[model samples]
Target: MKSILLSVIIIIIISSSCVNKNNSVQDKEEIIAVLNQQQKDWSNNDLESFMDGYWKSDSLYFYSGKKLKSGWENTLNSYLKNYPDKSYSGTLKFTIAKISAITPDSYFVMGEYNLTREVGNATGTFMIIFKRIDGEWKIIADSSC
Candidate 1:
């Protein structure tokens, strides 16, 4: 009887651990989905929607080239000024190279982006740090290469 009970408890523990692992994977997938939508919105030239992926608070930070930008609105305005419209935004494609959930509420992702259009094309790499707030993942700090 003792042996049987111990086996059952061990099995239960193993099953519970598996469930937790699966849940973690699902959470990571949700974050990835948010990032994917962000890319699509940018490609569609919807700066407003693209901005949705970012943390709306003043704590948001972004670095592009050699300049460091802060605030959500400032980032959006800069994007609009640089991209202007669909012609400049072009069709964007992102290939995610690495994505890791650093903690229950934090993630780090690295990806390469390409813009396609009649005029020209630009390609670069991006690294983003996301934090979960109010059950939603938002980019807290992002940098481009």
Candidate 2:
């Protein structure tokens, strides 16, 4: 009887672990999809849609150049000011360098962003922290150089 109970307990533990691992993989894929969509939106000059990947919260943080911006509204405003038109917005591309789970519900992503424009081209690296919020992966913090 004791041996049977122990065997059952071990099986339960193993099953739970497997389920967790599967969920982690799914989460990673979902996060990557969000990033890809953002890139696509940017390329299309749809800033509003691209911002969908970011957390729509007052506490959302974005760091670019030497300035730190807080709140979704502020970030949106900054983007508008910087890229007011299609020519300024240019075409955006992203190359994901690394993505790892920080916790069950949080992930860290490092990538390179390139903007090709008729005026000039710019390239930089970015690191973003994503959190599972309301069943969706959203960027909670972004640091782009």
Candidate 3:
């Protein structure tokens, strides 16, 4: 009887492990797909669509250069101010270096971004935190240089 119970426990653990592994892979793929969509949105010069990747809340955080801002609207306004138009915004390309899970519902991504434009080209590195909220993954925090 004890041997049977032990076997059952082992089988449960193994099954649980497999489920967690599959879930983790699915989470990563979803996050990567979101990033890819953001790249496409930017390339299309659709800032509104690009901003969909970020958390649409006042608690959202963004830090870059000497400025640190909280709130999604503030971040969007900054992007508009800096970029203004396609020539200023350019074509965005992201090279993701790593994406690590912080929790089942959260992740951190480190990557490099390049903007090719008529004005000039700019390259920078960034780390962003994404959290699953309302069954959707949204960037909650970002730090870029």
Candidate 4:
């Protein structure tokens, strides 16, 4: 009886570990999809749709260059001010460098962004913290350089 119980416990632990690993892969894929969608939206000049990947909360944070922006509205305002039209927004592209699980509910992602615009071309690197909230993966914090 004791050996049977021990074997069952070990099996349960292994199964749980496997499940967690699978969940991490699924979460990473979902987050990447969100990033891809953002790029598509930006290329289409749909600012509102691009912002959908971000956390829609007052506590959301974004840092670009030397500027620190707080809240979803502020971030949206900054994007609108910086890219007022398609000529400024341009065609966006992303190259993911890394995506790692920070926690079961959070992930850290680093990527490079390029914008082909009529005004000029722009390229930057960004690191983002994505958190699973309300059953959705949303970017909680972002830093672009």
Candidate 5:
């Protein structure tokens, strides 16, 4: 009986260790899903829905083109002011270069964004940090240039 109990313990530990090693796969998938939804939201000119992926807190940070914005509301305001409408907002497409884990609950994504609009087409690289908060993943910081 003791030997059986010991074997079970060993199996449990081994299983847990294996799960921990590959846990990032699940996280990556979740992050990708969020990005996909954001892309769809932006393409539909749903800025509010796009912002749903961001951490709705005063600590949220955003930086882009000689502008620095802190707080979720400020970031949303910036998007509203700059984009204004679908014509200006354009369709946002993201080509992810890499997604690296910063911690168990945090990751930094580097990618290129392309905007298709009648006014002009714009492209740039961006680095955004996502952190798991309140059982959901949210963008805590964004730097686009």
Candidate 6:
């Protein structure tokens, strides 16, 4: 009985270690790719495509400058309201200053965002939380600072 219990403990530890390692590597690559795609889609001024990088469920949430926006539709509507035209959309440019994995399947990303438009250049900093869900990386929760 003691030997069986010991074996189970060893197995559990090894399994957890492997899971953490795999999740760490995958989370890093997935988050970077998702962020990169966001910039690409924004630069193209494709709102629909840009939103694809985000978690599309009803639970998806975002906060900007103290304003909390919940759900995918709300976020999309806000974007459309703000950037109605291509000129307003401008070209999305981002510099990822830092990205840290907070857990095996979660990350905290901080970056600077800029838009070059006919009117002027608008810039801001953003901090977003990304989570891996069902083997895909999604922005489960986000807040722009």
Across 1-145, the per-residue lDDT of candidate 1 in tens digits comes to 9999999999999999998789788877988899789879988889899999999978899999899999999999999998998889999888889888788678898999899976699999999998989988899999986
lDDT of each: 0.90, 0.93, 0.94, 0.96, 0.93, 0.85
lDDT of 1: 0.90
List residue ranges in candidate 5 displaced over 4 A: 1-17
Instruction: Give a tens-digit lDDT track for model 2, residues 45-135.
Output: 8898999999999999999989999999999889988988878889998899998989999999999999998678889999999999989
Model 3 stretches astray by more than 4 angstroms:
none
lDDT of 5 by residue, 18-45 (tens): 8976988888889999999999998888
RMSD of each: 2.0, 1.3, 0.9, 1.1, 2.6, 3.4
Worst 10 residues of 5 by lDDT: 17-26
Q: Which candidate is the best by TM-score?
A: 3
* TM-score, every prediction: 0.88, 0.93, 0.96, 0.95, 0.88, 0.80
- How many Å off is the CA of 134 in candidate 3? 0.6
Model 2: clashing residue pairs? none
Candidate number with greatest lDDT = 4
Error of 2 at 72 (Å): 0.3
* Candidates arranged by TM-score, highest first: 3, 4, 2, 5, 1, 6
Candidate 6's TM-score reads 0.80
Candidate 4 residue-wise lDDT, 35-135, digit = tens: 99999999999999999999999999999979889999999999999999999999999999999999899999999999999999999999999999999
Q: Model 6 RMSD to the real structure?
A: 3.4
Which of 2 and 4 is the better model by lDDT? 4
Worst lDDT window (10 residues) for model 2? 80-89
